[model samples]
Target: GDDAKAAQRVVRQWLAKKGITAPHLVMENGSGLSRAERVSAREMAGMLQAAWRSPYSAEFISSMPIAGTDGTMRKRLKTTAMRGEAHIKTGTLNTVRAIAGYSRDINGNTWAVVAILNDKAPFGASSVLDQVLLDLYRQPKLPETASVL
Candidate 1:
């Protein structure tokens, strides 16, 4: 569609400015709503990691849904220890269900998590993604990169 193509152009220009050279990043509208778009879990994770390292990390993280508090995660993970511990963004499409966020672990370290499911019957992806975040919260510590800043 024209909109997707236009978004792709904008993303390309932004990526060029940022010196991000992802040769394999393809068919994306930067909105994750296009059927033609494709981003691997690893790529999404890398994006989250980069966001965490950026100077705007606090701003970006705060913009996401707060678990059991507001936005898309308002009711999710509500009954778990993960409640109020994560700031995440969710994506949904007929064939794609994804989540990306920073989850604060027990040790007060924030971990970036990105999970996506591409399946004909992706019925339980949200629950699975929530579990992933919860597991991160239960971890003894965030990944080593969390200490970089």
Candidate 2:
């Protein structure tokens, strides 16, 4: 218990150094199952983006579950165009569902995506989240006159 607490303290310090405020994150314990543990979707997306640009990006990306291929995502997005184009981590609770990670679009651009639903009746929220990824994967090309910058 002492060791776990110490690890949590270290993690909190590191998060603080990264400028993640208390409103964005609250770690009750190492286990994500804690009701008090919280992180906003924006913060999760930011973290994913940071990881994507990190020196250890390859290792970090490889550790995530590939959509419709492995881990918790094995059966998800199986028939979609995004099946194998995403590396994501998923979380679930009785009233909460979330997904956060990088997804590659048909145009070869990578995008960070995060969706979290905290509802009293969050039934069918997974499909909604899946659609969000699919939409990103199938995004239409912007016109030449339109600047993405």
Candidate 3:
């Protein structure tokens, strides 16, 4: 998480001055691993959109895991179309499955989606439904450095 206390706190504070309220902030560890935290779909997208237009967009994008390359997302999602075209971050646990990232279509329209599923939400017959969200960004090609993650 690029909070105001980060080295690039100036960038984070700039967004705050713009009336952007990052409420519902349960991210004490920065990483979304604790079972005590949750965020709305809308709020997650707002952060993604902000990162895209922010000065730290490149930094944020570069930190993501490359599909079939590195990080947790590399193992499960080895799809042919997603191998190189997609890059993302992944997380999993007995009570949680989450993925969040961006995907740029051929038309150059970058669309970001963050989906979260909780087992206690009563989504279906099974109460322990943990579906992993593998967010991937589709681009023309993966850069040389990212070819290996």
Candidate 4:
């Protein structure tokens, strides 16, 4: 569909506005239907992090799949500490797997998470991503230093 092309142009414009020159950015289909679509984990992470700080952050976060509650993440990460702690959007294809969103660490730190894998077997990829969320939740909390605000 031409929506992909339009979306790609808009993304490029946004990147320019942010003064980010991502030479490797490639978007062939907005729905990720085409294998030609390409993106790096780093770029996706940057996008998610920016969304976290944007004025529409709440809207963006609310659109994601809440872990163990609803959407694609509903059935995943259930019965774990990561349940309801992660708002992730997952993507899968015959040869591609991707998950990107935000999660809170044990110390209440919001982390932007993104993982992209091009593998023949993507069945177990979600578990790997969920484990990361669980690990973040179980990580030891560092002593809080005095804030000089």
Scored by lDDT, the top model is 2
Give the clashing pairs for model 2. none
lDDT score for residue 1 of model 3 = 60
Over 3-111, each residue of candidate 2 has an lDDT whose tens digit, in order, gives: 8778878987776776654466777776889998888887776667667767999999899999999999999999878889999999999999999888888887888
| Ranked by lDDT, top first | 2, 1, 4, 3
lDDT of 3 by residue, 1-149 (tens): 65524733563476477555556645445456666656776566677777777788888987997655677656544654445444466556565555567654444455665566555433331212112222223343543632211
Deviation (Å) of 127 in candidate 4: 1.4
Task: Give residue 19's error in model 3 in angstroms.
Answer: 4.6
- List candidate 2 stretches off by more than 4 Å: 1-8, 16-22, 140-149
CA lDDT, every model vs. true structure: 0.79, 0.82, 0.54, 0.78
- My TM-score estimates for the predictions, one after another, are 0.80, 0.83, 0.61, 0.84
RMSD of each: 3.1, 4.0, 9.0, 4.5
Please give the distance, in angstroms, between residue 34's alpha carbon in candidate 2 and its true position after superposition.
0.2
- Model 3 lDDT on a 0 to 1 scale: 0.54
**Candidate 4 error regions (>4 Å):** 1-7, 140-149
- Ranked by TM-score, the better of candidates 1 and 2 is 2
Q: lDDT, candidate 2, residue 135?
A: 80
User: Model 2 RMSD to the real structure?
Assistant: 4.0
Candidate 2 lDDT: 0.82
